[model samples]
Target: MCLCCFLDDGPGSLREGCRRREPLWIVFEVSGTINLVSQLSVSSYKTIDGRGQRIKVAGKGLRLKECEHVIVCNLEFEGGRGHDIDGIQIKPNSRHIWIDRCSLRDYDDGLIDITRQSTDITVSRCYFAQHDKTMLIGADASHVGDRCIRVTIHHCFFNGTRQRHPRLRFGKVHLYNNYTRNWGIYAICASVEAQIYSQCNIYEAGQKKKTFEFYTEKAADREGSSSGFIRSEGDVLLKGAQPCLLQGVGENCVFRPSEYYPTWTLESPLDSLKDILQICTGWQAVPRPAEMLIVA
Candidate 1:
């Protein structure tokens, strides 16, 4: 069964109505903001679809306290000038969740945080701009045991104004085809037992800035790995034609694009990367990253 409705035009109380329905599909038609202080608790089979740019969810936005199979798409979450106004907060034991095609900005804790035993999640095609902390996959490795939550972040853009924690703790994370610019420290940091597969991602620092860095302590360093897969066509490193740092280990996993992705006008290096990885890994066809930008 499928359900579809709008939240903006609904009269009376929106939260009361939403609470009553367990499985629902809500669409936001108006262009106002809604503040959620405690939590906008959703059921397992609920989807909140913001119809185009008509709705803006203000305040702390949706907090999936302990829900599963919930999907949120195509909305803007404004923190509204305060701290801890996180866009989406996923508590522990939440699974099978998807957050796609949304813009979250100006928050204190983080744009999206998965804390306390959360697993099997996907965050794709989202834009996180002007955030206090960009994306926190795990709160603390100590609290979540040795196994950190597993997440896939594909085709997202994070414009960090300051040093933000992209992925904290340790987990199996696939960060593919994302763009990050103007960060104070590491673009993506994996502290403990993290198997990070990064491919076709672009990282740009401000003037006279560095690209990427990784850190780990001796006790927390339990086989944390970082690998660079392939480069995009417009990668600045490819055009510069310098010696690339193809691979490195923890505490030394800093990759500069200009070194590996040097531009060669004669041959298309970007196109060749696809075929190269296939022959080595025996993977059939490479997948293109998601495109999240929508201009109307």
Candidate 2:
């Protein structure tokens, strides 16, 4: 399945090609920026590959609804602004997903959202900038099903983005080896009994940026005692930055993310993360397909 130069199969458009094809690898043959008026609804067992060339999808983005075994990489999503629209929308039924080396920003909604039972997802090596409400792991406050949502965000660059770098509601989130430069409002928000483990990250908060650690959303309708639990270790906050941990979140929960699942363990410290993550984040080093050659 190749989406080359906005070519569509029929009346449905590029979005339909994604749904009609199964267990397929979609590659972009066209280079440079292309405009999109509609979103591409991704299906299961699909990989959107944007290697070897710069493929930019603007005006709208992609959505993963009840999808599995999906991989999206090396694509740029820009100028996405509308209600219920985002760079990528992952619903509860999405699972076994990997989104890597993508540039997502300036969306009307969140850059990425995993909610309503979405689990087993990994977002890595992506660059996020010029957006507010960047990410939302769990969409709403009342969805008890969110307790099943689990995510891993590593080696990504959160640059000058506003809050929800992501705000979690339930389940365990492991965020490590990430660089956040100049945040807005609060970075790393955990609301409504969420368990967050943050480690080995670099936070360079700007003059107006507030709070690098976990913060609980204090709303009128929420219980005063229901707060998220966050265990932070080996993080570096630069000048004009202050770290704060709010009270009353994940009151009775545990902070050992590795305990929930053995593989979630993070061995890298902050010192080494700064060196490695410097070249990993953004679209700096996109993984080429196996057949592509590398020059020294």
Candidate 3:
């Protein structure tokens, strides 16, 4: 139903609606910003759909902890402050999530973090700008449980984000048809047994031209030779973006998206692809009902 609460803290609030046990398709009737006092913890089987109305969530962020079957679409997340606070965090056994067409920026920590055995996620058509530590897949080297993480990030725009276009620890990540530009340190990182498949993506560098960075960390499970692996196919690097030196990491075999899903939209990394991402990604305006009907 609709979140008619413009204040965002009432009984008919977005927080209360998300706390409900039953599945809900939560939409917004009001067009305004919600300054969350704390982290908005979402329940299982919920869809926070923000179409037709421009809804911005700031101050705090969303925490998807130990939940499943969530879809966050067409929302704007900005100015998340505090220690270890992320714009959107999916962790600790959360699965089957799709974060699509959202704009996230200026977070104290990561914009989006999927870690701690979270899997079956797809982040598509989202825009990330003016943030640092952008998106992180796995938590760290010590968290070996993150080896089960499998994420697909496609058709997203990473605009001038400072690092971690998604730095992972140990996981299988699929990066396809995405655009990342003007990163401060590095564009994509694979650390400690992570497998990344970069297919038909564009990486444009501005001042600092380092595109790929790899690090070897000791995982809790592994004994020796702990390093990440990435296989790039048909990716475009521009503006003096340096190519990755460590091309062959793990036996020249990285997991491909075609092995799992049957089909997906694919495009060549052309210069015009930058225009498509800037124009089409992030929140969009659509038609919706004028009246608010909150589900009980």
By lDDT, who's the top model here? 3
Best to worst by TM-score, what's the order?
3, 2, 1
For residues 28-66, what per-residue lDDT tens digits would candidate 1 score against the true structure? 334456665555666676666664434566665566766
Better of 1 and 3 by TM-score: 3
Q: Give a tens-digit lDDT track for model 3, residues 1-296.
A: 67878565777688988888999989876798988988999999999989889999999899999999999999999999899899999988999999999999999999999998999999999999998899999988889888789999999999999999889888999999999999999999999988998889999999999898888889877787577888877889998999877665464457768778999989989978879999999998865555645564
Which whole-number lDDT from 0 to 100 does residue 259 have in model 2? 57
Query: Lowest-scoring 10 consecutive residues by lDDT in candidate 2?
Result: 5-14
* CA RMSD of all predictions: 10.1, 4.3, 2.1
Higher-ranked by lDDT: 1 or 3:
3
What are the models' TM-scores? 0.69, 0.85, 0.95
Q: In angstroms, how far off is 172's CA in candidate 2?
A: 1.5
lDDT of 1: 0.56
Off-target runs (Cα >4 Å) in candidate 1 are 1-14, 80-83, 146-148, 217-296
lDDT of each residue in 57-84, candidate 2, tens digit only = 7777788988899998888888986787
After best superposition, candidate 1 residue 210: deviation in angstroms? 3.8
